[model samples]
Target chain A: MRPDWIAVDWGTSRLRAWAMGAEGVLAEAQSAEGMARLDEGGFEIALLRLIWPWLDEGQAVPVVICGMAGARRGWHEAPYRMLPCAPVDPQSLVPVAAEDARISVRIVPGLAQSRPADVMRGEETQIAGALAVLGDFDGVICLPGTHSKWVQVSASEVVSFRSFLTGELFALLSEQSVLRQGLVGEGWDADVFLAAVSDGMSHPQKLGSKLFALRAEGLLQDLPPASARARLSGLLIGLELVGARSYWLGQPVVLVADEGLAERYAAALAAQGVQARLLPARACTLGGLAAAIGQLTTAVSGTGRKA
Target chain B: MRPDWIAVDWGTSRLRAWAMGAEGVLAEAQSAEGMARLDEGGFEIALLRLIWPWLDEGQAVPVVICGMAGARRGWHEAPYRMLPCAPVDPQSLVPVAAEDARISVRIVPGLAQSRPADVMRGEETQIAGALAVLGDFDGVICLPGTHSKWVQVSASEVVSFRSFLTGELFALLSEQSVLRQGLVGEGWDADVFLAAVSDGMSHPQKLGSKLFALRAEGLLQDLPPASARARLSGLLIGLELVGARSYWLGQPVVLVADEGLAERYAAALAAQGVQARLLPARACTLGGLAAAIGQLTTAVSGTGRKA
Candidate 1:
């Protein structure tokens, strides 16, 4: 039986599922239930609700799931596959067997680094997608998201990567810290933000102590919240830039992210005199999955195996 | 009437009031609550309570206040006099007339920067003391406290200075933010703290973002909380170092602070390759107030008047 759907990317806080026809043409798409909404019911029930609208009366659709859905706490625990190798194909994907379910669902395992003991659930697909699109670009590919991943891709494979909690740090600081008192009502000051970045770069040693100065200087001197927020942002981003620099110094870097994050990275790169371009994350994910599927189909044909 | 005794010193958290004899011997020492505690009671009441104990036994001892007690919300709100000027003396201090009491009191105002509108309530006294002792040292003097002040002293005149909010940031970030989760059981990791300082100094741009990385990385990689806390401390101190470098770049620096704060500054300065000597804040404040008083008395006597 030929499957109607091709891929699905389910992550913490969000979910995305795409449908493809026999020729890899995106026939139709449907999404309703998000991963954040699913808690009690298992993956089978959740996946069914998401794809039920696009399903025919009696058609069995094979769906491949990636991201947090593959984590230990997700629908089913898909084991981690280390780096220096290609991502597993859809057919070779791990199956979640339910005693009372009829639909077949496969989940992709996440990747882990032994030395750092770091594990990533959704970034692997994005890296795989980046590799598929770039063909064989060496150096580091930074995937910035809620948890930003700095992956080192060499020889067409993800050699190693370090995850910097940049986004989460921003969220925590902006919304939670005393620095929150210094944030403006709406919009951000690019000039202030950039200046803060410069300040961070120039006085990296004073980074830790200077944070309080924001409040002291701003409060005593009455610096505007927008400027304070910008400084806070600059301070955090500056720290991340330093860590990321150590990993990919003088290397051609490709940032895989959405538009907003891409712009932020671009600004940061410009400050450091490094050029970076943003590659659409979803497109790369699709391309990478397609490549994985193509490899699997070719292998099956070469082995003369029956479906 | 000559006061029985004079007690004076500027503290970070609180202003110290003293009951002294004509010989300036310590008769009785009392803390008039704390600067942090003054936010609620309106400065007048806070000041009265500090000297209330000394006013017992039907003796109305004339009281003099220096430090934060001289700020806008303080007792009389003495205006800040800029640098290249002598500290305002108790005799020449601004008098706050009590509407319903016979006890006379005066409040000494702090110095302010006109452009930035930055003001220091208690630091001026310490600066005066540093001047009294050194008389002519052309170097940067750092007064480390809750609101640490880094002032440039040149031949008995303050050229320029900047304040860093290092201590407060540490308090807020460690106790308030989600980073608290990572710092729950961890005491203090000097190595981690120092490493964080280096990391902060190297990449000031990313300092702000690196905070949340503590928790996220901990959850994903299980980084110890003590290490996270140390990183936080290091980050803050590193930032301070960055800011302080400009002021203390090539010149010698004298760090005037209490024992605990002095040690912290010493560690941070040593890490940044800057030489610093920790002078007790209490002694400096006393010395500063004494010098200011001596100058004020001389000015009054020379003008054929008495305070």
Candidate 2:
């Protein structure tokens, strides 16, 4: 009997589910009632609702979950795997038996950094996807988002990665700080932002001292808020550039992000004389999940489990 | 009749009061509560407690207040004065006639920047003191504190000034941000801080970019938190230096601050190629109050009022 699969990526604010057939083609896709909306008990009910339309007559399909859903506070704790592991490593997948016999669930484990006490729940999949796409290129891959990840990939394995809390800083500065008061009704200016980006990359050492000049210059000579916001964005991105540069020396960088963010990264990278390419994040995530599932299937089959 | 005099400097955090005799010599000094501790009814009661000791000694003193007490939400709404007005300008002083008895009160007005909608409540006194000391000079005077001020003085008058929220930013970043997680202790390295300060001033444009680098560099390479704090301090102070330079133009600067802040400014100024003299804040405040009082007394006497 061929097994039907449901793939779910549950994140901080949203939940996305995809139904895949044996051939790994997207049969049906549904997203609803975000992760934020579901409680522990509600997870099963929500999952059922999402995959209900994909279920054939008298057939109960198994589901695989990744991202924050497998977190300790999620539906079930998917124990994290330490470094020196591949995306296709079967040892990293945690099979969780659901209370109901009709439903089978498997969760992908997160990655942990012991020294800093930091962990990433969902980005491991993206890293896996990047590794799968690169096929054993040793270089740096930056996944930019709310919490940016700079992962070092070697021999198709994620050696290690560090997360920078850049987005949170931007949010706090733009929304909470005194800069926010001055930034009311401001919009993004690409020119100003890029200029700041170049300036930041050129002088990574003086970052702290330069921030106060924003308010002082603005008040004294009436600097536009848009420029201030752009300058702020440039500053954060520039700092990230310096940190990322330290890990991977003079090598090509692959940035995995959406179009807007990719553009920003491209500009920042160009400023630092580094070659960078934008990789589609969604495509990489899907590819990563497929690779993980393929590995799990092979492992189970080798163990003489029914296919 | 010889008029009993009261001097008050109501700053952002504290309210200090000094009772003066008929000859304008400080007879006794007292402090009750802080500006932050008072609400509506709290101010009057707090002020009475501060002056009650001197009042109990048979003194019917008329009080004069400067700083935040003159703000709209402060003790009473003392209206703002435009630029080029002395601190003791009789037309600028907001006098509040007591509802009962011979007790009278006067509040110094704050300055406002029309474009940025920013206002300074207390730095005017420091500017006044700097002017009283320097007599006549065209240069920038930096009053460093929680809300650091960079004022432009031209010919014994404050042309314009900008308030940089540098101290507040440092406090928030060090205490609230992810950088806080790394900061285990708090003894600053002046060398590290000065290096960062120099780096910041040289590349004032890159202020925003270097902040996130702190977390990334610290995490990936284990950069010390104390260094991070110093880096942040340097960034803010450097930015202030850049903004101040536009008004500074290599002119001799009077840095009015406490000892620690004075050191920081002295180092930052040295990097920026400016000669700065550290003026004790207490002395400056007292000198400014005295100058203001002298002007007010002369104005009242010129109007044929009994001394």
Candidate 3:
């Protein structure tokens, strides 16, 4: 089957590419050479290494890339499109001229807000994909990962959004901070997590003190590792929820994440008496990239315009 | 000059020792071998390495140690004393048996609070030292460091206290987070810092968003390094102040730190309309240990009890 184009999520640590035909995914490939590890002129080679088997001798393959590849220090700087705009705009695509004609690459621009001063690169792609799942949806879409983003989508456009350092904070606390002593476990305590969410929402100011308490609790009372880990995670996530109440309160929420992470968010929201629907994992980023490509294809095929 | 006893401040990263006599004239020494580095049976050797010159052969000299040396994993497991107690109890000192008969060692116990589940190892000494300067200060004492502590002292007893990770957060965010890009300076911005402090105190939940803004503001608006650094510090400290409102709302605040750090806290508190008086650096730690020793001296000399 002849492929139309490849959708790529090129993040900081890794890259995943899917060769999509007119029907569906023809082939999928990935690589460890993410944007962070590759230097100037390395991106083209890295992309080719993974998808070389899928390319033809003379044909050009459209590869739409999102995430860190669009960062200033990445392959090419795709300037951010400010918020209160369409999640994916055809005008925002930044083209990267590939040395090999077999690779035609374009990177999607990220989103930025001015007043609160927040930015999102890859998560915006997921936001675009979100619109595909729920056409004309008006609500909050939360994409949780290393950097969790709570986006407000209304009328097929992102009115505003906030990025929380919750995931990073949880990772840092569990691995690097004093809390590491008692947080080495895969087990979790749901009760502790829910209670923690209540505490965090009620007394947002007690966050710093609560963080230290995890370590103290472990030391003074020999808190179980599972409880310690769960408490630490719940505390941070709860802190984020308290901060992001404006985004989800009385608003429909659509969580976009893998099953585990999304369920975590759903449970957290449930604890707060809020119902949040979940979108299939990786649907948003892929759908978002595909949606963006659809616009380019339309512009290119219907009229002579930049794709 | 020969000293009466040696007062040592041993912490996670370094060790500082002072040879104290009845009079003021004495000697001081320091070493990089803090409690964190040494393994089992390494504490005695590390101590002697720094303070060996002060010892008289075969004559046992009383040595008082404070800080992390009393941590459960430190030189010896010096149990933490529960709060609503004296800063340092004579009975709470854990005696460390030294191979060298010339070195008679006593380690001070740290303070712990139960309700909020918090603990402090070294700051209690600083609290005691504060009492030395401001006799019977019935107010709050702010000890700003890696883990800043806001203590409530009344009638010469530590009634209650709270620990804030403000200093640690500043170090991590400035050196490890994305904000580090715009925080490589020794500059200060009074207005920006004051505004950020106000925001932090007024809306503590905005911490997650405000943190991301440091990086975004740098990328979009070309924010200055000094202002970025100042804003980050001010925000964390302000959030802590917000949580610790019960300690310093209308009560007096005594800032105990080195001139520069103390001045930072003083400035931050002044922005909140709270006047914080500054104390000489390290005086509290030394005085707190001295005060505790006075209790032992009175017990041994007057009551013929454990010295």
Candidate 3 to truth, TM: 0.93
Tens-place lDDT per residue, model 1, B1-307, is 2345355443435656666655564544555465545663455565555556555444445555677666554555677767555444445577767643536566567776654335577787787777677767889999876567888777566666667767766776677554676788837778887888787666665654466567556756778877887788887777677767788778788988888667767887787777787678877776766665555557767752332
Candidate 3 lDDT over residue span B275-303, tens digit each:
89998767777887887777888776777
> What tier of docking accuracy does candidate 1 attain?
acceptable
User: Candidate 2: what is its chain A TM-score?
Assistant: 0.84
- How much is the lDDT of residue A130 in candidate 1? 81
TM-score on alpha carbons, each prediction: 0.66, 0.65, 0.93
Question: After aligning candidate 2 to the native by TM-score, how far in Å is the CA of B287 from where it should be?
Answer: 2.1
Worst 10 residues of 1 chain A by lDDT: A25-34
Candidate order, lDDT descending? 3, 2, 1
Looking at candidate 3 chain A, the ten consecutive residues that score lowest on lDDT are A298-307
Q: Which ten residues in a row have the lowest lDDT in candidate 2 chain B?
A: B52-61
Clashes, model 1: 35
DockQ of 2: 0.13
- Candidate order (TM-score): 3, 1, 2
- Lowest summed lDDT window (length 10), candidate 3 chain B: B298-307
Q: Fraction of true inter-chain Cα contacts (below 8 Å) kept per model?
A: 0.47, 0.08, 0.59
